[model samples]
Target chain A: MSDRIRIVVLLFPAMLIIVVLFFGGLVVGLMRSFNYMPVIGLTEPNLQAYWSVFTDQEFFLSFLLTFHIAFTSTVISSVLAIGAALLLRRRFVGRALVNFLFQLNLTVPHLVGAIGILYLFSQSGSFARLAAEWGMIAGPADFPELIFDPYAIGIIIQYVWKEIPFIGLIVLANMQSIGEDYESVARSLGATRWQAFRYVLLPLLLPGVLSASVMVFAFTFGAYEIPALLGANFPAALPVLAYRKYTDVDLAARPEAMAMAIVIALLSAVMIVIYLRYSRRRIRD
Target chain B: MTHVSIQSLTKTYPGSSEPSLDNLSLEIASGELAALLGPSGCGKTTTMKMIAGLLEPTSGDVTFDGRSVLRDKPEHRGVVMVFQNYLLFPYMSVAENVGFGLKMRKVNKVEIDNRVNDMLALVKLPGLGKRKPSELSGGQQQRVALARALIVQPKVLLLDEPLSNLDAHLRFEMRDLIRSLQQEMGITTLFVTHDQEEAVVLADKVALILDGRMKQYDSPDVFYKRPVDKATARFFGGQNFLNGNATNGQFKTSFGVLDLPIDCRRGTGTLTFRPENICVTGKTTETNTINAQLVEKIYLGTQTRLKLAVGTEFIHAVVNPAEVENLEQGQRVNIAIPPESLWVLTS
Candidate 1:
């Protein structure tokens, strides 16, 4: 009994810190969104901040753009990660070097990757200079605008480049845990190499793929630095918009930014709940 | 029809000093069950994988019914395998797992259903078609694996230590189940196992392999009653070794000189006999009787095992409990060797 009591006492500080950092912050942000804050001299709670967040034209466009970039990048990255994992499952010369290069992106910051993309795809970038030297393009004006395009293609490409390695590492770990017996059995039952992969390996890898997609989605959705650096001028991503609103000259717009933050959190929570429900149904059946 | 024939099968892994399988040759007749019995790293599983086309042989030719199958893939070889862990697809229901092969082969839906149902019934898992493998017990999962393999109606079935993962009692039950199923289906089968008892019980003929070489291939009874070499003799529970000389039908050992019931070449060699053949009695009236002290007695319920020390050598014997009632530890007893029970092996 004394040992149990001592263990609880030891865990008390860490648990309290977690509750404050996670749930407490969420509650405070949500209350601010409802305009119920005494620190800023607002006593009566209201929904004015939420209405502003919902009615802002830039907010709606940026929110949609955020969804577009995150969904596109996550889907493309997951598919490519699965392909790379399958290809590298077997042994070959210099395999360790290739795996190391793929995992190297995890250590580099997203801002650095965005800067690299900008240097490579901008108007006076190396690609445009090379195309001009090759006589394919007359001048820098002929080069396609990849960076800061209205479609967020540059941000999507950057996110995919950074997130593919993370997804690949997770998938490779899961693939290693699956035993070789499943493949052997499928082959002996008259499945070709591709057939075995399609029927057996793919089904067993579904859970890992779904979870990795969720992680990639969450990471890409909340990302601020990459989008802030690469997004279009008029309509930025939700995180970029929130950061701008929070630092506005008029302190009255701060509540709207908090509301936007709460909305983003709610969206991610809803996505996670939906994913879990679907995965549970799949496992149950 | 000859289901499987291997001519000069060999395999060498990269970075390994020696080949795993070297110049091996085997043949499995149609409707016969054969076991490749050996210890770990003895190339039993390697040989099975090559036959299944999962591993490419370095230099060899595998034939099915006189046609070379080396160029064909695993799906075209008409063979199925059951692994030791019963690798049932966790995502698929039992029925879907069993029917997957048929569906892959482009069989019609109705035919696949009938065949799947038939296989499920055969494995005694008739109503378990809707449950996933994770929801079932180990034995049931193994049965589903068996059903999945057999549903394809392949030319041959390969079983790699299919019962090693079960408990002792379940192992026995599954052993009998597999044997009965094999006899019923009559599909040419090749089973790999390290357990000598399992091989002897389930195989019509056992091929004892060691170090990438075939030591002996014969029926279990013959392999036990008359082993060809010292290693084969020792592997089949032949525990007693007597330094003796054989002349026609008689062997002269330290205990006594006795005549065997059969004739052999006249030579100076060693004689081997099983422990069960050496009887122990209270009196020394029999021929070839040596008086020795009982070293240990182990009561095995049905039979009591006794150890006797004669000079510098110790001998083991199993006797009926009724005959060993008076036998006690450290008691003097007479060890009798019947003449016809002794077997002679050269070198």
Candidate 2:
């Protein structure tokens, strides 16, 4: 057999599964949102579901809250990752230990991480218990609701913790491949340490950092587990809102749920599009 | 005035026993260009880095105008190094790369632009400022690195094998360019290179180092004529070395007794001379003569090189190409070593 034909034959099954499971599901969800689902006895297609979901005040609040959490977490995580990467670029005594500790999250599930956050920062959790014992607060209620708050502070904190090492790994790889010449050359040219980092290494590291940030933003925007556990009821994140809508008892709400799901998917698609465009432009330059 | 002085500078890597650079001291006058010529891993670059305040010395101190600079950082030492790779920032344009040092000093934008332009013009890269480093040719990139190092007006300039990266033709061109630029700027400079011909051609003084130890330091003219040892002589393209016993103004060798210029004690020493100085003669009426057979002959256009065996000792010689055009291998010839061209070494 020809090499090209054999290679194509080997790759065909995986590609077929991915296309059916991912894009096929997206297409079916889009069609169902338009009221074309024969399984639910919906006969006619209309824009009623999209219009209703777009006009819903609760849905709008959820969308905005999701955006807020994603944006804040991504920015903070990316900056911290860049700092950590720079700090660890030079080998030190404890560098291996630090690297191993941070990368430990990569294998641990995000759901587990969110629950861990719940145990640490929830109203009656370890932090409040410690605070109460230390006389920092009178009781669990006085500890302030960090988790399940309207701000989604718990979700943002968890996202930042989980995504920093991901972005930091990418940034550190870029730093290593560039070696030490750029920074050394900068210092020799009368640049202070800060100036050398800002002028030389920062510009080189931006593309990696921004691309990693885009990945975190897209993932956090659609992820349901963290927001589901830590977010409040009314202004829940978009994925959580979509789940609640999808599980409603009234059958008429199926179309609205699917519409919201499509919108969440659309948000991730838009983020990915921006990442590709921005990275392509950088590559061309 | 001595612009820079390194006093007993030594560097030993953590895992190594012998020091990479051992008790090295040298002085460079203002506006003089000195070349630290050595083979790879001979501590030339280490010495330059120590002077630049990039690498800390194991023991001694470096000073500029009689003040110790060991306490100062590399940024404040007024020392600039143009690395061998010509590490131009790929993200920045040529003008920005040249203006980077000035920007670090917080010079105003207008002054930076003006100085950048002037320095670019000085390096013969005028009006090419808008282009990025990737767009420029290798020679142009080298010019940008030079312009960048010079724009800051450093007190001392260090060039680490600046021309070693260029092609042979560009090497000569950049060599001349470096000469003119160093003369015009009048900055005290230390250049590190392994190429002996480059050192002799470009430097006012050459310090030849070997195995992390300095063998000789003098003007290129003096080093070429009188190398301090056999290693230094061999480094500067020496091939013919004859060990002989010397007494008074004469030397006893396997072939014959030869006359000498320096006062020689009663002991044995090695005789060294350049290949081109050993001439071929039909008969030696002047006393220093030997019958040798030509083993190999290589005609290098202007000069014909030949290895001759005299009493089981091989001596390499270069002759005028026209005179030895018909000379063939395995032929017998008479070789002569004149008194003035011979230098005696103990080892």
Candidate 3:
């Protein structure tokens, strides 16, 4: 056989799984999103599901809430991650233990983390009792509402907590690969320590930081479990709301739910494209 | 121009018993280019960092023209260093990289642009300012680094093996460029290098370092002709060492008695001479000539290396190929060593 054909044959197994499973599901979802599900006797494809989704006031609210969660969580976590990486890159006592503990949660499932946040941060949870005993609050019921609050503070906290180390690990590796030479050069060129980091090291680290952050943004944008577990009932996170529609007794809501899912995927895809373009320009420059 | 002085600089890294840089001292005259010449791990880089104020010395001071700079930070010390890899900021343009120091000093935009262009012209990299550092070749990037450091008009310029990352051809070109620029600008430069030839060719004075200590600091010719010890002489390519005891002006070795210079130290010592100083076919001198059988002949392109035996000890000499063309391995030849070429090392 030719080399090209042999390589394709070898890659066929992995290609089969991705093309059949991932793109296949995406095509099916796109089909239903246009109201073309033949199982429901709707052979005609149209934009009615999208029209209904865009017409709903609650859809826009859920979108803003989801955007807020993703953007705020990503920004906060990215800043904290950069800070942590800078500190961790230096040599110190107990650094190995600290780095190990910082990355330990990456193995834990997101659902488990949401549950932990719920157990600790809910109004009647352990923190509430502790606060009541300490006279910070009169009773458990008087504790501030974090979970199931209108602002989705609990959800944002969970994401920021989990994603800090996720992005921190990437930024740390990037910092190490960039090394201290550039900063040393900057210092010798009459730059103060802060200026060295700000001008030279920060610009060098931006491409890696942006790529890692885009991944976090996309994951948090489309994820459902964390929002569903600790979200308000009135205007839920977009994914949670879409899932609710997917499981509703009304069969017509299924197409709108698929439309929302496709919308979420499109937004995340847009972010990834921006990231790729930026990194490409960086490499070329 | 600034007179650079390093007084008893020492550094012992944490958890290490041996000092990385021992009590080292140097006095570089204003506008002089001095090289810290040593093998790798010989504390050359350590001493460079101490002078640049990038490293904290365990106990000592670095001064510029009689002012101690030990309390100053690296930026405040008015010293800049060009590193081995020419670490140009990848995100910046050539002009920006060169003007970075002026920008840090808050120089105005128009002035920075003018000076950046002038510096670029000085480095022979004019009109390449719009390009990024990554787009330039290795030699060009190195020129950009030199321009960047020189644009700051630093008191002392420290180069830590600056040409080490380049190819052989580029290394030679950069060596010429560095020497010309140092002479042109009259900057007090302390260059660190492991190559003896490079140190000799570029430095006004070369300081030979060995095992974390300064062995000898003198002019380039002195390092080759009058090294302080066996190691320094060996480092400078001295191949013939005769162990003997010198009393008054006469040296007694296993081979025979030879005349020593007037300043030769008395008692037990080793006498060293360069290989090229041994004349294979020449008029015999009365006291320093020896008759030995040629044991081996290795044909080098420009010179032939002949191993000779005087008694049980072997001596290697490099002579013109034409002089040794008729000589055979077992044939005996009389070789003369100039008395002035011999340097006695007491330690």
Candidate 4:
């Protein structure tokens, strides 16, 4: 009993910070989302903000755009990360150096990566100048519009570049711990190289890959800065749209902004719950 | 069944000066079980991997049924190896792991299930098809690995110290199971072990390796009777050695002159007699008898180990405790050796 009390005592400080700052903010925001802020003379709780959010067509478009960004980034990053881990697991000349370079960008902040992508892939960026100098394009306007475009290409490129190493590092460690023995045994049992990788290695690696991709998906779904910096002005990502409403001059827009934030958080939570269910089922299988 | 032959196989790993396996050559007849016995790092596993086509030989050829299999990949070689740790797929159940090879070959589901069930029965793991590999005990996991390999019906089976991870009683059980299974299936099998006793008990023919070199390749009985050299004799538990000069079937040592075995080489060498072969009696025999005083007596449960000394030379002898019930330290005793029991090791 004392040991349990000691553990709880030791955890109290950090847990106090998380509970007060995170759940405290969530509870306050949830109350305001129901339009029950007494300071603004709205003492009666109401669902008007959620009703307006659901009735708006732009909110639906923004949700689809956010979903597109998160899904595209996750799928592309997962495939590229698996490919990188496979190659990195093999021995080669200067393998340690290659592995170091592969994971070097993980320490970089996502905002910094987003800015780097904008500088490289924007209409007036270095690539446009290069194409102009090479006579491939007449001017900066002739370069393809990849930044602040309808497809959200620049934001996705930034996310994939930043998230690959994050997912790949986890998968590489899992592969190294598993070692070559399982594959060797598979080969000895008359499995071809591709068959061994597909049947034996891929299934073993799926749980790690799934967990990492879920985290990336949730982060991309609710992130604001990358989309705010490099998204279409009309159909902005959900978080950017919510921040826009929160900063509106009209005070009634605050409740709607809180409702949008709650919806985004709930969607991400639902995805996490689904991922947990899937991984648990895989383990049981 | 296929005859397996490893012809002059040699392997030098990268960045290593010495070869792990030095020009090793052996041939196993079809449906025979051969053992590669040696101490750790003596190239026993290296030789097994070379034969299994898991490691490429520097300059050699491996043949199966009189055809070269050096160019064949490990998957195409039809030689399955059971690892020491029994690397069953952790995510797979027993039935899936056993039927993995056949699944790769695209065998029908019905036949794969039938064969997997039969293989499980043969390994005495019936009705364990639903359990995961992690859910089973160590011995059961080992049987699943065996069943997995045997379900493929490969041309040869390679066991790389498969029972080294088991407990003593489990090792005995697995040894008997492996022997009966190998004989019943009549598969050409090669076993690698660092244990001399395991090699003797499980192999039809034993190949002794020492320091990346072949020491002897013969039946188990010959190892005790005619070891190639002093190291071979010592490895096989030859405890008593007398440095002597042999001339015309007679060996003269510091203790006394003794008749050597008929086929012993005539030279300045050492003669070895197993401690169990050195008889202790109350009276002298016809020949090869020496008087010694018991220096120490160790009371083991089954037998009493006696340390006897003639002048300054000491030797150990093991006798039944009942026979030496009255023997004590500092007592004089008669030690005798028969001529046939003495073998000379000229090294």
Ranking by lDDT: 3, 4, 2, 1
Candidate maximizing DockQ: 3
All candidates in order of DockQ, best leading? 3, 2, 4, 1
Worst lDDT run of 10 residues, candidate 4 chain B, spans B278-287
Runs in model 3 with CA error above 4 Å?
A1-6, A272-285, B285-287
Give the higher-DockQ candidate: 2 or 3. Answer: 3
Candidate 2 lDDT by residue in tens digits, B147-259: 99999988999999999988999999999999998998898999999998899999999988898888888999777678888888889889978888888888788887788
Model 3's alpha-carbon lDDT is 0.90
**Candidate with the greatest TM-score versus the true structure:** 3
Model with the higher DockQ, candidate 3 or 4: 3
| Models ranked on TM-score | 3, 4, 2, 1
lDDT on C-alpha atoms for all candidate structures: 0.85, 0.88, 0.90, 0.90
Q: Compute each candidate's TM-score over C-alphas.
A: 0.91, 0.94, 0.96, 0.94
In candidate 2, how many Å is residue B81 off?
1.2
Candidate 2: lDDT over CA atoms? Answer: 0.88
lDDT per residue as tens, model 4, B122-195 = 99999999999999999999999999999999899999998899999999999999999999999999999988
Report how closely model 1 matches the true complex, as a DockQ value: 0.69
Clashing pairs in 4: none
Candidates' DockQ values? 0.69, 0.78, 0.80, 0.77
